[model samples]
Target chain A: MNATREELSEKGKKRRDFITLTATAMGGVLAGSIAWPLLQSMNPAADTLAESITEVNLAPILSGAALTVIWQGKPVFIRHRTQQEIAEAEDAPMSALPDPQTDKSRVLKPQWLIVTGICTHLGCVPLGQKKTEPRGEYGGWFCPCHGSHYDTSGRIRKGPAPTNMIVPPYTFVKEDLIRIGESS
Target chain B: MAKQSQNPYRHPFVRWIEHRLPIISFFEHTLKHYQVPKNLSFLWTGGFIAGFMLVVMIITGILLAMHYIPHPDHAFDSVERIMREVNFGWLIRYLHANGASLFFLVVYMHMFRSIYYGSYKSPRELLWIIGMIIFLIMMATAFLGYVLPWGQMSYWGATVITNLFTAIPWVGDSILEWLLGAPYVGAPALNKFFALHYLLPFLMFLMVFIHVWALHTNGSNNPTGVEPKTAEDTIPFHPYYTVKDLLSITAFMVIFAFFIFFAPNFFGEPENYIPADPMVTPAHIVPEWYFLPFYAILRAIPDKLGGFVAMISSILVLFALPWIDRSKVRSLTFRPISRALFWVFILDVIILGWAGAKPAEGNYIIIGQFATAYYFIHFLILVPLVSRFEKPSGLPESLSAYYKNSCHD
Candidate 1:
């Protein structure tokens, strides 16, 4: 509508449209290319990358118990979930969860649920690895820092956290051993 | 607004670039050709000076940050090493430290200039509020920066101020602990302060962008406090005001250079030279001179919560300036009683600062209470009441009329 009638020939209009479309596409590519380096810089620095791969011995963890291991300077929780904790987690309606994750889908084995202990909000480590510490109302992990309660499946059921605890790329090398960091 | 064909300075390459970007034209339109009132005084030059000082602070801050450590154990030692050994480190450090004080000096003068002229009146209310917010951010940024040195004053100041949060009822203690990141001001507090100090200048930069944008939208308020009615009353910002601003900056730098070369430690407290001693408390603890007036107001009240509220209220009171002084006349030049009262208020503030520096005991406490009372009275009662009753002098018909009258004199 801003264009004058003199410049509104069908061929001229088509040409103008093509130019605008081409320019927009080029701008998108330019913006992405410019943003690439900044995004790359945040992708875990060299020191963090060096410590990214961690091997955990699964033999030490007992049923209904969790062990925390350091991977990329973050606490990763590996729980040997008992049948009761698994049932309780399985009974949770996924639709009702703040961050919905089925207990079965979160674990590789029926008895083991491995997740990063870091809270989705503000990155404080949740506390449920020790037997003495409060496992919160959901009986999994309670973040004393801000009171985010994680269920047995590490799905955020309550408090300020917006997502389930992240499942780091991990695979069992043997029945008693596992390696974290690289996806199979 | 500039077209390629109309742009005299546009080369073929520039024309081609302008077709795509037009950045040069944007600067030309915004900065070079922007019209400002012709009768603006040296006080009006404060914005340019403040902008120049911000750039100086950023450059010096970046250089200092390169050598400074954030960790509590190494922070003091690293600063000392920078002062002693690093190349031109002493110069950069002194510039940043003294630059902060000078920044406050210019800002306070700018604020007072705004007050004397009714720059905050009417449509410029948002602009004035933004300016006050910038002042607050500057205070926060300076406080965080002070803590990075891990000096005696830095430690105690952080402790005392952060502990002020505890005056709140239910969530106070938790908030204080969260702010400190521990039971006391230690490593966690130091690290967080360093990060925030680095971040806040960028936030200030964003606020300044908005401030300038808002200023352009409304145009500047001049000494006459009259809007420019004709093209004859205004001039392009570039050659006229730019040159004047440059001259003012040159004069400022001469004083700045004197401080940098000679009496660098004059503005700084001697206690800051000592490393932060948590075990030992200094007999007298005072904030930087700029904060002294508010600090005086804090000590004036007997109750902790009352003191905290009073201190905060002093700064928050500034946001109401646009509304509080209900006068039809703009500049104090026309209002004789208000003009006299403005000076009294300034003297009251200076006295408060002096009292703040001294211990909160005996005569000093009495002085602080009186000054504090006068400060509120000046704003709450005098500004509004005086505006209602005071008879202002006759106004000039226009800026040109004032200029013509001045020429005759």
Candidate 2:
């Protein structure tokens, strides 16, 4: 111990500090590299990420009727909008909406509106897909869990939901075929 | 430390080994010869019980883990299987489950006892901080362990807690996904949590070792809070504390046994017996009873981010306590005003726990809001002000003078 102390004293403070710093930097990088893999391993695994697409044929849905499909383990509502509903959605004042989105901007065509059925407030499946189900004041969907109301455009119009209904990434795979979870 | 004289009786074998390793002496010093404040009351038994509880939890936990399946589908049924199929498995599971509650109960008493005696003061601050770190690890371990059963309360509790991170700005959602390992709680989250839950207790054991090392440096604070100044003020560890602690442990086991045998599910939510369903959230979800105070604090704030911050700050503030209350007197027995405030603080925590059990609406919310406000007030404002201003009764010249060798060896 005395000999080592003498040697360190001879090396002087500056050299010892440099040696200490270098060793610390090396140790930190080594630790970080070891930790990175352990951390990255926790991200979504390949099978889970492979939750890709759900194809829904619009042929069966008449105007004013809606179809509910399950995509990515969540319900997605595809409503064939009536002309009057479309017109009403288009005319609703933007300032009145809790979470605002233009009706035209929300849909690809004037007669079709598609939005994920889960409530934005908390993840409850909203009521509105069936004719007998109660849609709230705006005539889109009503969340029984928290009483959130959506308009014809599937925009959050009232109650506790913080934003408009989510529009999952989707595209028209065919004129009558809409594939959810794939965007192109 | 006082040196031990060499034994003249030479067992050549034992002496040779002792010269090389000294492991026997190390154990002797810590377990047999260490001096403690002579006047320590039964309250000091909390530490011994806490250490004993750690052993119970780890042994029971490891056995339960043997039959516990980590996957969501098998998790709930496997717990039931353990209860039904494995001989004496129900006893082991109940011991482990109820063991967690008792462990927390003991630890909370351990902490509050320290707080009441001002044991977090100087020279003991690092020991207290290490104890706090042990506590944080305990909370994390308990939470991860709770989710392993994968029932309604476990699943929803995971969802609620993991989502709280999303209240952070910019990187919140990313952090939440990283924590859960998916868009939501599932197999990945369960696997990671199980891995961590098993690992933390060993880490906590190591921390407790350090905490004890820190404690031995300054020795224990007693009811009088006066430092031992002479040999007369202290007692050896072997018989006095060991027998007293053994007695206390035996007495405590009776109550713990009552819970394990008679009220096995007393600390658990009935909803947890039902398997987890992702689609339907239970109308009211609650955490384990031990978590109630902090849980109430979380919901007391209206804003998501604010509530998360407040709840975290409640714990983090304790780490700063040694500096916060800088009073010269170390125990509440000397500070009458502080003692009154201490009891009130205890009541506020119980009220918060009560509020936490109720749904977050109506009068419950209002009650929680008041209790939450008072908790912070008592800690940050009242403690400091009282510490600064309270007239402590004149302290004894020495612990020997205080006890008058009433507890001689």
Candidate 2 docking quality: incorrect, acceptable, medium or high: acceptable
Candidate 2, superposed: residue stretches over 4 Å from native: A1-25, A56-70, A73-165, A172-178, B1-13, B403-409
| Residues A1-184, model 2: lDDT tens digits | 6569878787798798999999999999999999999888877777776766999999999998998887765568899999889988999998998777898778887888989876665455677887887788989987664356898889988764667888888889889999898875
Q: Which pairs of residues clash in candidate 2, taking residues 3 or more apart in a chain or in different chains?
A: none
Error (Å) of candidate 1 at residue B135 is 0.5
Lowest summed lDDT over 10 consecutive residues: which window, candidate 1 chain B?
A: B1-10
Residue B22's C-alpha lDDT in candidate 1? 74
CA-RMSD of model 1: 13.9
Q: Model 1, range A1-184, lDDT digits (tens) per residue?
A: 8867776786698998999999999999999998988645433334433535899999878787778887754568899999999899999997889667678888888788889876654345677887887787898887653356888888888764557888988888889888998775
What does candidate 1's lDDT look like per residue over B231-279, in tens digits?
9889999889889999999999998998889999988889988998664
Ten-residue region with minimum lDDT total, candidate 2 chain B:
B1-10
Supply the global lDDT for candidate 1.
0.83
